[model samples]
Target: MCGTELTIEQSGIPEAIPVEFCYAGWQESLQLLALLTEPEIPDQA
Candidate 1:
């Protein structure tokens, strides 16, 4: 979700609502979310 302004008053939170603490720009931020959500894999011998 991408937009020019931060937020809206009347309509209330447009479709471009980003996840909390995700920030606005920088693709790395999105990647960070993916990494955090990834399941931990056990090491195989």
Candidate 2:
């Protein structure tokens, strides 16, 4: 099995939250990689 991880901390957050974004296939994996880079995608609500 394959595994990966991405850790990040928000502006006011103290500890780095571990985001276990698992991917099923290569196409999905690529998408995850892209997301991992941009850790600052502010929510638009």
> Model-by-model lDDT, in order?
0.55, 0.55
Candidate 2: pairs in clash: none
- Worst 10-residue stretch by lDDT in candidate 2? 17-26
TM-score of each: 0.34, 0.30
Give candidate 2 regions above 4 Å deviation.
Answer: 1-24, 39-45
Q: Over the stretch 1-45, how does candidate 2's per-residue lDDT look in tens digits?
A: 646675534354334543332223444866878788656868999
What is the overall TM-score of model 2 with all chains considered together? 0.30
- Write model 1 residue lDDT over 1-45, tens digit each, in one string: 753333522335456765542445445765686688767999998
Query: Which one is best on TM-score?
Result: 1
